[model samples]
Structures are given as structure tokens and as C-alpha cells.
Target chain A: MSVTAAKGFTAAGIAAGIKENGNPDLALVVNNGPRRAAAGVFTSNRVKAAPVLWSEQVLKSGQVSAVVLNSGGANACTGPKGFQDAHATAEKVAEVLGRGAVEVAVCSTGLIGLLLPMDKLLPGVETAAAQLSEHGGEKAAIAIKTTDTVHKTSVVTKDGWTVGGMAKGAGMLAPGLATMLVVLTTDAGLENDVLDEALRAATRTTFDRVDSDGCMSTNDTVLLLASGASGVTPDHAEFAEAVRQVCDDLGQQLIRDAEGASKDIKIEVINAATEDDAVEVGRSIARNNLLKCALHGEDPNWGRVLSAIGTTRAAFEPDRLNVAINGVWVCKNGGVGEDRDKVDMRYREVHIVADLAAGSETATIWTNDLTADYVHENSAYSS
Target chain B: MSVTAAKGFTAAGIAAGIKENGNPDLALVVNNGPRRAAAGVFTSNRVKAAPVLWSEQVLKSGQVSAVVLNSGGANACTGPKGFQDAHATAEKVAEVLGRGAVEVAVCSTGLIGLLLPMDKLLPGVETAAAQLSEHGGEKAAIAIKTTDTVHKTSVVTKDGWTVGGMAKGAGMLAPGLATMLVVLTTDAGLENDVLDEALRAATRTTFDRVDSDGCMSTNDTVLLLASGASGVTPDHAEFAEAVRQVCDDLGQQLIRDAEGASKDIKIEVINAATEDDAVEVGRSIARNNLLKCALHGEDPNWGRVLSAIGTTRAAFEPDRLNVAINGVWVCKNGGVGEDRDKVDMRYREVHIVADLAAGSETATIWTNDLTADYVHENSAYSS
Candidate 1:
């Protein structure tokens, strides 16, 4: 079941002439509420997009009824007009759905700093809202993508509760809480405070740990809307765990689909002085492009790995650190230990384990190998 | 005139058995001064090579008479024995020069965490000392290269003084400095404190600002040695300026020879509220692989530029950001303005200007385009 399969939600996607390719560019998702509890996470980048700023303010109410997203023009750095365009989109959505304009949220992705073609957008929202249906999650996922080869959707079912989500992102992925645009829906009865707490906790570990290319986006956001339609609120702990699993699954898919990526790499930092240190070490390695490229080539260049980990301020002595790639111990007690040729990287998945030997804490980060395709795709992205 | 041109200095480069290619992998430089005075800068990475730690300790006295470098093994994370190897190298150099071991420094770069081949290294040092000469800067530069296609050397001549240097690095380059190994010599009468101050200031603006691949190295070191042989001491201001020019020239050379780089990019962040903010903004843009790749493809994707700028903590409203590429104003006040066709990126050099509209502070960072060759070269770097 897709995200829209959740009770009390309807979604629609449509072509709006915003893209020159005539692909679908508008998506609308509405909460058929038994409850309107909602929470959101936005990009931490100080330079934010117009739609991000607007949504951040709207989310202050901790309540939302609908979301309107458009792809093709990011509506970022478009000055005051960009904000106006976002508000106008919300107003149009509210007008069509007979709801307050403030109850609608907006997101835009594609090229940044370009004015959204209002001529195509206004009518497109009306069409999307009118065509909204219970099974439109897949279409909505496909509409809000640029350069992504496929749509990403996930669902989790419990005894009496269910959680579902859709995500869209191909590049500009990094840490800052939420790294991309993800919309989650649930039929379990949940309070606003509980949903907010759970989302923050899940995001801190899941979406926040995916670093595809270490480029943070201006429009990254994640929103969760709980309809309480099932009237069977599971234990808060169970719901939170389920939410994390959904996010983890979708995050993995995003990494798999990273632009020009051939392999997905998982870096685990263990025996750290603290959880934060472990995460910092993992992130340091995940963001190193040279190491990532080396992984793509299947070269167990532990030197690059050591160099990456050394860049972080995490507490660890170089001599005590241990490194293993693909389960082969390449270095032990800070020195070469295993034959590099014994480690193989022919598969699409790669794992690297770094032992800090300082404490007991551990953390893992997911990333993709840097490839020539990534360079080729990005170099001509704006052209 | 090069680094070795300084009076009271003898240098040599020779091929040791460390590298499989049989390239020149060992180098020796000695400061033939009545009173040795030196200052060094090492990589800020927390994970340091064994030689780095050893040298860092040996440089505490601010007096170094000799430096030994090898380019086939990093000797990092090799535990206590690695430290012994570095000390032994220094002892060997000192013994041949008839000086104390404490007065010599050591550096290594190449594969990390591998034990030094003491059998080959000991004999190689003796040969290097026997062959040391005044005009060995060219060979010394070649000795410390890994993937670099050419040697990098720079010299500056003032009214009564001269400063010259050589460097080796072609990959694993980024802010917080690149994976560079540099040796500088000056035929100027200066105190240890003065030389340290000049080196710091020069490096902050030059080597510290060139980020080729955003990967910090564990064995980055830049050492400056001053000889009173010239008997011509100039004002501190003049000496500092000369040092800056030499560093700038070498830094540019490094960028020109960066791996697989089709274009050298200069990113300028102006009108920032503070120098730190300006640098942060400039570095953010320089480190964006997507933007670098876009520059390679000659696409004026200003959206990517603004998006990269948005990732920094600089104080600027998204709408007020102005960006120009290749002298053409592609984005003004945060929105698309001039015709993108007017911006041409066909040349090997590209300039990007970002106006923060905050204040007067500014910073410039140098970088290279991301290409397929970068991936291909780095993938097999260790093997």
C-alpha cells in the first residue's frame, strides 16, 4: 500500500506545462482529517528557499490539512515574488478545497532561483485538487522528481495501525535534519505532541544520516500528518519505531538512486567516546569524495579512509584506530593487517567499519560512491 | 632560483625501493646554517600520520636543520614502530650531516598505514646525502609527487632577499588545506619568530584557500627554513609580501595541475558581514562537486551556484544574493537576470563572483572542475 492508501488522505499528480518536457509537474495531497496533527522538519542551511521559508512559518501552528508541490522550478532566490507565488499556490489550493489558505503547505524542487510560471501553476493546482484520489501517492511521488529514474514509496503495517510515506530526491543530499522532501501519512490515532516528538527522533537518525554528495539543498523538507483514522493508537514507542523503519527504507532507496551512483556505501563508526563522536567520524568519511570515488573503483585505499576520519575532531588516537572494508580487516591497531586483494567490491553494496577504540558508542551513515556519471550529470545540470 | 637556491642549503632526490614504479620516492634537504630556524604547518586532520606526529614534536624547538621526505608510503597509523621509523630517518639525515637528530624533521606521503621499508630507506638516505647539491630543487619536487603530472616550484626576488619553494600534490585537495608536502628556503636574515609569522600569514591566504577535491590528507606538511647566508635582512613587511607571492604562485600551479581538471575555478565571495563568513561562503561554493562539474561542462547553471551559496552561514537573504559567472551577470538579486548564453565557460580558467549584500568583507577560493578522469585516477590511486 502507498502513502495515499492511509485513511483520511487523498492525493493527485498532473502535468502543468511548468517543464519543457511536458512531464508531470504538480502534486496535491489533502488530509481528510479525523485529526490534523502534523509536524515538519526543514533544511538547516542558513540560505533557504522561498517555499521553505513559507512552510516553516506555516508549520508553527503544528497543524496542516494539505500540501501542494511542484517540480521544474525551485522557486528559490526569486525575491519577494517567490514567496508571493508560494502563498498564491496555497490560496488557490485552499480555494479549491474549501479550506483556509494557512492550512496548506507548499514545496518546490528543480532548478533554483527561477520564477515559477504562475500561468501554468494556478490552473494546475486546481486540476490536481479536483483530481485528487485515494491512490495517487505513486503519481505524486513521480511528479516531484528531477533526474530520478523511479518513484520511492514505503508502507508499514501493524496490528491496528499503519504508516506510509513517499519521497523524492536525487541530488543535493546531505545532513541538517531532513535531507529531502518526504511526506508521511498514518491511520493510527496520534497526538500532535507525540507525532512531533517521534518525527524529530526518527529524523535525527534516519534521513539525517544520508549524505549522497554532501551538498545541502535549499528546499529539503519532511512532513508527517497523522489522521487518527484507525482510532487504534498503538503504543507511542511502537509507532516511533515503525516511523523510523519507514524512513530508513526510503532513505536507503534515495541513496541507491543517487545521481550517477554505482554503489551504496555504509560507514559504521564504533567504539567511540560518545554517539556524537561516532556520528561525526562516520559523516567525515561519508563526505570525502576521494574516498567515495576510490570505493567506486573497488580499491581498498585505507589511506584515504584514514585521512577522512582524521579530519574530524572526534576523540581517538591514530594508533588505536582500526579499519575494515567489506568485512576484511585492512588495518588493525593502526597498522596494515590484511591483504587488500582479499577484499572485493564488485557488488553494489559496500561496508566500511572504523573502530575508534575510545569508548562503546557507535553510529552508521549511508552514502553513494562518486562516479564519472555524477560529474557528467551535474556539469550539464544547469545547461 | 628555487627553494634549493637559498645559500646554506643542500638537497637531493633519489628513487628508493618503496614505490613499485621505481620513481624518485626519497628526498633530503638540509639547512646549512650557523643557527637553524624553522616553522612548520601540518594538516588539521585529527588522524595524523606517524611521521607527522614525530615531526610535530621535533619542530617544537622552532629549530630544524634538515628534512627527510618519502613519497611511496604515508607511514600513518603504524603504531610505535612508525614513530621509530621517522626518528630513525631523522637520525640518519643528522648523522650524515654531522648534526643532532633532534634538529631534523621528517614527512611521508603516499599509501597510509604501511610500515616503511627500513632496508631500502636506510641505504637510500645515505645515497641522498652523498648526492645532495645546490640545484636539486627540481629533483626534490619530482621525488614527492604521487599523481602529479609535473613538478611545482616557485621563487620570489626582492631588492635584497629571495624566497623559493617546491611542492608536490595533485589530489586529495580541499580547504583546511590539501594533501600537500612543501619545502621552502629563504636566503634572508630573519629570526625564528619572524619566519613563523610570515609562514602562517602566507599559508592562510594561499595553500589554505586552494581546495581541489575536498579531501584532507593525514600527511600534509609545509615547512619553511630561513638561512642568514644572504646577509641582507629586509623589513618584515617586505619579507611577508614576498612570501605571500611565492605561496600564491605555487598554489596556482597546484590548481593548474589538479587531477583531471579541465578548468581552474576562482570563487569570490564579496560583501559578507565578516571575513569568516566570506570564507565560509566561498569555500562552500568551491567544494560543491556539482558546481565544479557544471563548470567543467560549461553550463551556466546559476541555480546550482545560488543553491551552493545557500548552504553557508553567511548573512544574506536569498533574494539579495547576486552571482556572476565568467564576467556575465547570470543571476542578480537572487533571480535569473542576464541571458545565460552570454556566460561562456570554454576556457581552462573560470571566475565566479557572489555578492552577499551584507558588508565589505571578501574572500576568494581556488578549485578545479570534477571530471571522469578524477574518478578514474583516484579509484586506482592506492593500487
Candidate 2:
């Protein structure tokens, strides 16, 4: 199940020939519903893709009937012509669905600074339009993948309503917002205001905390569409919980499929003076090259962990800090503690707990270990 | 010529079993001068080494007679005992040189979170003092090498006076003093105030611009000692220029010796709205993992260059930015321009020029390409 797992949505993926490899490169998801309301989160990078610039405008209108997406070419840094291509994509989707251009959002991912093949992409939109079906969510998810090894989807069904979503990303995955393209669909009769509030809150905690490779994307976009087909108005708190669950699941999938990573590391910062301090400490550890390398080697090198934390400005006394790796407190009071030999590293998941010993706040950020494969994959090509 | 190239200075290197491999791990540089004026710079990292904390106090006294350095272990994150160890090392040097303890400076590098072996280090200082000579600069430089394959030193002789320096760093090199340990000595008859001004001005542009691995150390220190034995005062502007040249030369050497790096990359950000903008953009490009990997593979991937620049807050128009790789304008007006194949990557140096088209300010940051060897060296064991 993907975007179409919720009621009143149809999706399709088709070969667009945009990629020279001739893989499926076009995807369309239509909200054929009694209510067309949506919310969106986009890349915070200053250099945005043309599609992000266009979708930000469409979301301002507080309505979205469909989304058009493609792979093989990220229409970023292509100047006026790139923006025109994205606008044309939205216009074509709106024309096929008998809606206004402002009601459609577009996303593109692949190599940057290149223009898309509008000749094929625009016509391929028509093919996807013709084949739109409620059971085509998986194909839509697969079409948007760049280096992702697997298509990701999640669904949370309540008593009478359901929330479903699909996401695609594998590299250039850092917060803000991980080069990911995602679409979440729900059939609970919520207004545009409710959808916008819930989307921002869910994304801030879920997608915003996953830092796969410490590279921010220029084409990250996550759109949440409400169709109101089930006519079951769930409680606001319950609806938000369901949406968050799907987002959290998709974010986990993104980290699990991160490029060339052998282990998934979860950095949990506890006893921070504030939430910001916790986040700062967590991010510092997540982006540390030496620490990530040691994690890949499974050395349980707590020294590197302390060094990474020392680089951050988080509030904590140097001698009061504590670090535990996989339930073994290898470092305490800023010195060597338990036997590092007791720390086992036989699993795909590594849990590192950094206790600041300053306050009661805590936060967790997920990242991956650095490996030779990461260097080889990143150096071999322009992906 | 190294730290002892200047008049009235003596240096030595010795081994006292501090390093398990029995390599020389102790160095001493003494200024037996008519004027013992000095200035220093230390790591800006919040978590500083014990030696850094000790030397910062020494510099505040505005005079330095000697500097003691070691390569076997960094007294960082070792708590109060570490601080006491650094103090005792300095006191030992002071006793041997017949100077006050407050007039001695200390520097340490190697692993963090471990205490130094005082039994080995203290006796090693006495051995270094016994063998000190004006011709022992090269030996002192070699003693400070950790992963550096070659020792680095620079000399500049003026009319009747000379300036000389030595630096050692192979990894954990980044801005905030470039994770280096350096010592410069001059016999130019300059006072402490003059030395301080010139040292800060020189380091601001030279050492602060090299970002080899985007990792800052907790024990980075650069010290300048003035011995007025030549008795010839150079012009203020000329003196600062000479200091800057020595720093720039040593900084370049540090980058060349960076661990596992196959290519030296110079990222030049030109035509920015302000000097800060230029430096920010230059540093962003220097730290980009994807672009570094692309350079390692000898692929002229200019799109990655643009993507890296987009992640910065520097003033630039997406449609007006231009990029040139090794004299080939591969990207112009934020889009593809020259044929990427025209660019050559056969050399060990790759120069990237980014034209922001916003103003006249410019800056350049030096970095190194990411390689599989980098991963292996950093992952094989914790430093």
C-alpha cells in the first residue's frame, strides 16, 4: 500500500524515456475526491529545484488535486527554462484532470543542473493519466527512486479511516529534508488548515531527524493530500497520530536503505539542557566522519564519540558527560568506564546514548556508518 | 631550516618510551633571546585539550621562553588529572630552561580522552633539553609527526633577520586553526604586542582557510616567539607579510600530507556580496562530500559543484552563478556550458572557481578529495 491505500486516490507510473536507461521515469497521483486539500514541506536549501519553486506556490493556494513526479533529471539550476518545464508539467496534469494548474504539484529528482525532456515527460503524463488506478501506488513509489534499493510505503488504518504514504530517497540524505520525495494520503475529512498543521509537526519530528549522508537535497518535497472520501471525521489528535506514524515508518525505511551503509546508528542524546542542545549534540555525532568510520569498523571507539560531542556547543561539563554503546557504558564522567570488550557489535543496529548530565531534555537522530562502499559509490558516478 | 632557523633559538627531539613503537615523540623549542616576546593561537573548539588550556594561560602572560610538544597522546577529555599532567610537563621544561613555569608553553596531539604518560613524558623533556641545539629544528619537526609522511618547515630571511616555522598535522584538519601544532620564531626585534597583532592577522587568512577533512581538533595550537638577537626592526607591514607567508606555506604542506587524500582541491569563491559570504561559500564547497568524491574519481562533475554552492547562504542568483573546473567553464549561468570531457583531472591538484555574480569580494579554501583509502585509514582503528 502507498498513496492510493487511502480512499479516493488513484496513481500510475509509466516509462517516459527521460532517463537514457529507459526505466520508468514518470509518476502521477490524483486525488479524485469531494475535498481537495493538501499540505507540503520542501527543501530548505537555498538552491531549490524548479519543481520545488513551483509547488511552494501551489501549496499557497491551499488546494491540490494531483501530483506529477519524474526521475532521471532534477530540473535544478536550469534557469528560466527549468521553471517553465515544471510549470508546464503541472499545467499538463491539471489539464488532464480538468482542474486548474494551481491545483497540481510537481517534483523531479536525478542529476542537478539539467533540463528534463519535456517532449517525452509531457506526453508521458498523458499515458500515466490514462492508466491511473487505485492499485498503482507501488509503481508510483518505484518510479521516483534514484539510488534507493527498495520502494517504501506505509499505512495506518483506524476504526473507519486510514492514512497511507510512499517515499523515495537513498543519497543526499540529510535533514532539510533528505532529498526525499513523499506523498501522504488520508480520507478523514480534515480542512486544509488541519492538514498543514499536522504535516509540519509530523515532518519536524520524523523526516527532519534522519541524516543518512549529511548532504541536503535541492528537490526534497513531501505533500500530504486529503480526499475526504470516507466521510469519517476522526478526532484531531488521533488523525495527527496516524499521519505521524506513517511518516516515521517511511523515514525509517529511508535510513535503512541509505546508500552503501552497513549499519544504522541511532544517536540518542539525553539530559540536555534544552531540546536544541540535544539536537545539536545528536547532529554533531551524526555528521562526524571519524566517528562514522569507527562505527563502520564496529570498534566501539568511545573516544571518537566524546571528540564529536566536544565539537558541539551543547551545554555540558566536560567531566560530567557519559556515553553508552549498545547498553554498555564505555565512557562515564568523561573518562574510560566499562570494558569496551563487553560492548557487542553483531547487529545491523547500533544504539549510542550520550548523556549530557545537564538537564532532563532528550532527542534522537538516526544516521548510518561510513564505509568503503560509500566512498566507491559516491566517487564512481554523478548520482 | 625550521623553528631554529632564526637567531637565539634552540630545538631538539627525543624519545622516552612515550610512544609504544619507540618513535621520537617529544620536541622542545627554546628562545634564549634578548627579547622573549610571544603570541599564540589555540583551538576554538569548546572541548579543548589540557595542554591548550594550559598554554592559553601561558600566552596571557605575554612572554614565552620555551615550547614543549609531544605526539604520542593528546591530553584531551582526561579531566583534572589531564590538566595536572600538562602543567607538570610545562613545569619540567621551565625547570630545565631556568625559566618560570608560566613562561613555558605546551602542545600535544594524537588520541583524545587518554591521559599522557608522565613517567615517560617528563623524563623525555629532560632528554630533549640536554640535546637542544640551534641545528635541531628538523629533528623537532619530525618528532611532532603523527600520520604525516613528511615533516614540514618554512624559512624566510630578510636583511640581517630571519623568520622560520614548523607544522605537523595529517588528519583532523579543518578551519579553527586547521587542527595543527605549529611554532614560529623570529629575530626581528618585535615586541609582544607587535607579535600578537601579526600572528593573529597571519593566521586569520592562512591557517584558518585550510579545511582538509572538515574535522577540528581539541589541541590545535600555533605559537610565535620573538628573540631580538638580530637587533634589526622590520617594518610592521613587512613583518606581517613574512609571518603570513610562512603560515601559508605550512598550511599548504599540511594539506598535501592529509591522510589518504589523492588530490588537493582549491575552492575559490569569487564575486560575492561580502568577504564573509566568499569565505562561507568557499568553505561549503570545500566540505562537500559528493564533490570531493567526484574529484577523487577524476570525474569533472560540475553539477555537484553547483549543488554544493547552493547549500550555502552566500548571496548569489541561481541563474547567474558560474563554475569553472581546472580552467574549463563547465557550468555557466547556473547550467551546463562547456563540454565536461574537456576538463582534465590527470594532475593531483583540482581548482574550482565559483563566480557568484553578486559583488567583488572573494575567498579561497583548500581541501582534499575523499578516497576509499580515507575510509580505510580512518575506519581501521581509532586514533
Candidate 3:
């Protein structure tokens, strides 16, 4: 179950022939409800995709009746024609659902700088609308994949309400909001403001910390909708927590399915002067190609860690800096400490602790190891 | 001809037992002159190596008698003992040359966070001092190799004077100041302040723009020594031009010999609001891992380049940007333009021209492609 797992929602996924391989490339989710409330987040990249620009405007009304997503072409960098294509896509969805054009959100994820197959996409929206059902979520999730090895979905249920979501992205994942296309739905009674507040709070910590390849996407977007079908008014704290948990689960799935990744690294910056410093230091370490390669080879090279740290402007005494691989302190007081050979790194998960010794603030950044496979996948991706 | 191409300089390189592989690892350069005028620049990294710290102090007097360098172990992060070892090495060189310890400069490269073999290194300096002669710059350049495939040296001769230099570093090369160790010798009669100004201006545009691997080292340094043996007080502009040419030539050599590089990429950002903005944007493009990988595979992926540009805060409108690869305009006005298939990339040198469409300011940054051999070389470097 995905977004359609919630009450008063229906979804359908179909093979639109937009993909040259004839795979499923279109998904539609509709809110069949007495109340329509929605909130969304999009990529902060200045060079945003056409769909991102269109959805940002539609979401301004704080109400959405349906969402149309396709994954054969990103519809980005197509100039003014790309903007027109995204508008036509949203208008097609609105006409099929019998809703206003401004009440439909749109998303596209695939090769950039290419026009969408409007011939296949516009007709596919009509077919998807006719087949929409509450149990059609898993199909919708599977339809929105480009290089992703598996579909990702998460569902959470309480005594009287349920929250469900799905995501699609295997590369170009980094901070600055969602970093991918995610759609979530809940049956709880909530207003647009409450939904927006909860969604922002959840993604601020979850989706904003997953940096798979250090390349932020231009088509990243997240949407959340609410319906009063369950008739349960959830507590604000409880609703926020549920949203965060769902987003966290989806973020982890995205990382696990990251392209050409052999290892998942968790860089935990501890005892920094401020939360921003912790995050800055952590991001620097996560983006160091040399350190990422060392992690891939399972070499406990703490020198690379220190070198990365030295490049940052974080305030700390060089001799007071400490680093640990797994649980062994390979670097203490910024020098050789415990035997690096004693630190075993034969696991898929690598934990790195960088202590800045400035304050109590901390942050954790998720990244993937650099591998030859990563190079191979991305090298020929666009061609 | 390298540093020894300049008059009044003697250099030697010897096989120091400090390297367990029985490779040549020690070099010595002596300024045997009537007038010893010297100036130096060092890495801006807060975590300075012991040799850098010692040499930084030695150059404060605006005079240097001799310079001793070793490449087996980088005497960094070893605390007080490392400083003591660097001081001891310089003291031995000064003792053999009959000069004060403060008149001798020290430099080291190779694995960080390790102690130098003082016994082998101190004796090796004496051997190098005894063998120092007028045409030994090539041998000195070869002795400082860690992962470099070839020795780097450059000479500019003009009007009865010459400026020559040698550099050593294949990775961890980025710009704060000089990101690698270099020794330049000149016979043009000049005062310490004149040489300092000329060297700074030369490197600001030459060596400081080379960002091979985007890693800043703790042991980066560049030294300049003028012996006043030619009795030619060259004009300031002419001397600065000669210095720039020499540094430019050596910098190119460093890029060609970058570890695991199959292609040398020159990212040129033009039409920026300012030179600093241009430099910032160029460096960002040069350091993009995905773009580098695409270059390694000969894929003309302009989306990665656009995504990289979007990450910078430089003043440029998204819709006004244009990019050309190998003289083919793949992207125009921030969108697709000419056929990407028209671009040719079957060469070792690749040029990327990004037009920011903002102003006339421009800058160029040099970098290497990301490859499996780079990963293999850096991963098992210390082991």
C-alpha cells in the first residue's frame, strides 16, 4: 500500500508507452473526499524542472484534487516549451478528474532536457483515471521509477487513522529538501496549515539529510494530502511524529536502493559549536571522494577523515579533534591513536564519529561509497 | 633543467632508507650565493604539517641558506615529536652547510600522521649535501615522487637571467594558497620584497587555480630563492612574467601526471559578475564528482554540469546560462540547443566553456577525471 492506503483516496498506474521499453511510466492519485487539503515541498535548485514549477503554483491554493506523475522524461531544460508541456499535463489530469486545472499537481523524473511524449502521456491520464482504486498504490509506486532497482512505499496506522507514502529516486539525491518525488496521504482530520507544518517538520530532518551522491536533483518534490474520512482529529505532536516516521522510512529505502552503491556511510558529527557547524562538517566528510573511496575499500584510513575536516571552517583545536571508525578510535587528539588495523569494516554499514569538541550540538549525514560501478552507471546514464 | 638551471644554486637527490621500498626519497637544494634573498608561501590549512610550520618560521627572516625535503612520510599530526623531527632535519642541513638552523627550510610529503625515520633521514641529508652540484635539479625532482608518474620541472630563460622550479604532488591538490610543495630558484638580482610580490602574483593565477583532486593538504608549501649571481636587475613586469610562465608550465605538468587521470579537464567559466565569482563557479564545476565521472567515460552529459552550476551562489540567471563542450554548444540559454552528438570527446584534454551571461569576468580551473585507478591508488596508498 502507498498513498492510496489511506481512506478516501484512489490511484492507478499504467504503461503509457512513454518509455521506449514499454514499461509502466504513468501514475495518478485522486482524492475522492468531502475535504481537500494539501501541502508540498520542492527542490530549491534555481534551475527547477517544468513540473516542479507547475506544481509549486498549483500547491499555492492549499487544495489539490489529484496528482499526475510520469517517469519517461523529466521535462526539464526544454525551455518555454517544457513549461507548456507541464501545464498541458496538469490540464489533462484536471479534465479527466473533473477538477480545476489549478487543483492538480504534476511531477516528472527521467532524462533532462527532453520533451515528454504528450501523445502517450495525455491519453494515459484518462485510462488511469478510469482504473483508479484504493488498492492501486503499489502499482503507482512501481510506475514512477527511473534507474531505481525497487519501488519504495511506507504505511503507518494508528487507532483511528493511517498515513501512507511512496518515493522514486536512485541517484542525484542530496539535501535541500525532498531530493526526489514523494506523495503522502492520511485519513486523519487536518487542515492545510497543519499538514504543511507537519510535512515541513518531518522532511527538515529526514529527506534533507540523505545525500546519496552529493548531486541535488532539479525535479525533487514532495506532496501530502489529508482527508477527514477517519473522522479522528489527531494531536499535533502525534501527527508530526507519524509524518516524520513515514518520511524517515522512505528516506532509508531510497538510500538502500541508491545506484551503484556498495556501502552506506553514516557520518555523525558530535560535539560541535552549533547545529549548523555539525551539519557543515558532516556534509564535507560525506562529499570527500577520497574518503568515500577509502570507505568502499574497507580501509580504516582516518587520515583522509582528518584531511576532510581540516578543509572546513569549523572551530576546533586540531589536536583536540577525535575520529572513530566503527567503534575503534583510530584518531584521537588529531593524531594516530588505536591501531587502525584493529578497526574492522566488513559490514555494509559504516559509522564514522567526528568529534569537534566545540559544543554539544550534533548532526548525522547519510552518504554512499564511491565505486567503479557508480562511475559506470552515471558515465553512460544520459547518453 | 629545473631549479639548477638558475645560477648560484646546487641541488642533489639521494636514496634515503626512510622509504621501505628502496626508492629515492631525499632531496637537497643549496643557495650558494653572495646575496641570499628568499620568500615563501604555505598551505592555509589550520592543521599545518611540522615541516610547513618550521619552514614558515625560517622564511620570516627573508633569507634561506638551504632546503631539505623527504617524501617517505609526511611529518604531520605527530604533535611535538613531529616538529622536533623537522627541526632536527633542518638543523642537520644547516650544520653541514655551516649556517644557522633558522636559515634552513624543511619539506616532507607522503603518508600523513606518521613519524619520519629520523636516523635514515638525517644521514641521508648529509649524503645529499655532499653530492649537491650545479646540474642536479632533475635528480632532486625525481626523488620527491610518491604517486607521481613523472618528475615536474620548468625553466624560463631571458636576458642573461633565468627562473626555474620543481614541484611534487599528484593528489590532495586544491587552492587556498599553494596546494603542493615547490622550490623555485632565480638568478635575477632582486630584493626579498620584490621577489615576494612577483611570486605571489604569479601563483595567484597559475598554481592557485589548479584543483587536481579537491583535497587540501597540511604540507603544501612553495619557496622562492634569488641568488643575485647574474647581476641583472630585471624590470618588475618582465620578472613577474617569467615567474608566471614557469609556474604555469609546472602546474600543467602536475595535472598531466595527476593520479589515475585518463583525461585532463579545463573548466572555464566566462561572463560572470566578477573574477571571484568566475573563479568560484569554475572551481565548483571542476570539483563536481558526477561531471568528472562523465568526463572519464567520454559522455557529454551537460545536465550534470547544469546541476553543478545550480549549486553555486554566483550571480547568474538560470535561463541565461550557456555551455559549450569541445567547441560545440550543447546548452544555450540554460536549455538544450545544438545536437549533443555534434560534440567530440575522444581526446585526453577536454575543454568546457560555461557562459554565465552576466558580465565579462572569467576564470579557468584545472582538474582530473574520476576513475577506478584513482580509487585504487588512494584507497591502498597507506597500506
User: What's the TM-score of every candidate structure?
Assistant: 0.96, 0.98, 0.98
Between candidates 1 and 2, name the one with more favorable lDDT: 2
Candidate lDDT scores, in order, read 0.86, 0.91, 0.88
lDDT of 3 by residue, B255-357 (tens): 8888889998998999999999899888888887878888998988887788778878899988888999999999999899799999899999999999999
- Backbone N/Cα/C clashes per model: 4, 0, 0
Evaluate model 2 with DockQ and give the value.
0.69
Window of ten residues with lowest summed lDDT in model 3 chain B: B171-180
Q: For residues B306-334, write the lDDT of model 1, one tens digit per residue.
A: 87787777788777888999999889887
Which digits, one per residue and each the tens of the lDDT, describe model 3 over residues A1-383? 99988898999999999999999999999888767899999997778889999999999977999999999898888889999999998999988778898999999998888889899899999888888998999999999988999999999998899999999988667988535799999989999999999999999888999888778778999999887788898998999999999999999898888878888988999999998889888888888887888888898888778877888899889899999999999888988889988988899999999999999999998888988788788776562
Sort by lDDT, best first: 2, 3, 1
Docking class of 3: medium
Candidate 2: deviation at residue A44, Å?
0.5
Q: On a 0 to 100 scale, what is the lDDT of residue A375 in model 2?
A: 86
What's the DockQ of model 3?
0.68
- lDDT of candidate 1 vs native? 0.86
